[model samples]
Target: MVFCIRRAYRSEQAGFRAGKFLTNPTKAGRGHVNNLRYRSSTRKKVSLLLMLRSSARILLLSQAASSSFITSSSPVSRLQSAQFRTSARTMSEMTPVFTKDACPPAGPYSQAIKANGQIFVSGQIPADVNGNLIEGNIGQKTEQCCKNIAAVLEAAGSSIQKTVKVNIFLTNMADFAEMNETYAKWFAHKPARSCVAVAQLPKGVPVEIEAIALQ
Candidate 1:
């Protein structure tokens, strides 16, 4: 059997000769057992080293990819965070403007509200602090409205000169010329404006004006 032949190869006195054991063994036969063990061990060590190198390369690549991904996304994340903070500040910064110098509100609204570096003045009619209507000509009524708007702006940490936009409502279009002349005097900077005729105004005032301005 092949097993019996291989067993004989390990014996000191055996040599390959057909199926018989020779009396004198060759040099290959003498050292075959130890040489086979050394070669097998060396192959195992080489295989182990190759597997370790492959694993190390995979680990390094994974770490490098993760670092690159983080680097690419960092700026976008910071930008989004900054935008969110700005939006929050804008939402939370609204403050009501109130001063005894301005005509009081006729209803439930504030005279003005300041937010995000701007002031929003509500429509002002010809009225005093007690909401009493002022009977006046078209030009005088327009002047009173502008004065109320100015007072509101000052309360909101801004000034009439800072006005950026204006809206005026009139009960009659015939008074447009008078209103415009009075308006030109108050808003020397000539802020953008729109004027329209309305059916009625609060307190029967002939003119009502609202303004928006920088704070």
Candidate 2:
């Protein structure tokens, strides 16, 4: 059972060759078509095995042009349907951290930056909410730095116990012992750390400390 398009069977009549209409004795309108197809009113599939008494190529063309069916053997046609699909793994987004309870940043930066399930607290000094350097000994100033870092981490949804790394800047190497004593009490977990003696710190403070903590 099959469908058929009744183009004057090109193979039956050798005289009816491919594109024979192009050699018409007399030309017609610009959009004139060689409408050589017909169909049966009934929806039943008709096997035109009798009508297709010709070459395989002619039968192939007839089946394609027929209105009742579709063929999908051409590579060019199938290639047009090919698509490039790539699944891209997306991760959670990051954001900045801020807290009015902590000393405001003295420069053009946020107190912390939260990213990839972690929070990075910026370097903090012994300054009050008013941005004034707290007048005290090295131990007191170190405590203040820890306090500020704690506040910033709390606002960023983290804490000192979760701190993974710490970087400290000291104006005087002799103050390292005093800063460590204060820093130790704040971080009982003893997170990784590095301290260096710089020529000076922000606002001429004795110490500055920054930290990275897990969320």
What is residue 80's positional error in candidate 2, in angstroms?
Answer: 27
lDDT of 2 by residue, 111-200 (tens): 999876789899999988778888889999999999999999988878888999999999999998988899999999999999898998
Instruction: Count backbone clashes in candidate 2.
Output: 0
TM values, all candidates = 0.64, 0.58
Clashing residue pairs, backbone N/CA/C < 3 A, model 2? none
Clashes of each: 0, 0
Position 88, candidate 1: lDDT: 95
Off by over 4 Å in 1: 1-80
Model 2 lDDT, residue 213, Cα:
95
Q: With candidate 2 superimposed using the best TM-score fit, by how many Å does residue 2's alpha carbon deviate from the native?
A: 40
lDDT (C-alpha, whole model) for all candidates: 0.80, 0.75
- Error (Å) of candidate 1 at residue 27 is 36
Tens-digit per-residue lDDT, 160-180, candidate 1: 999999999999999999889
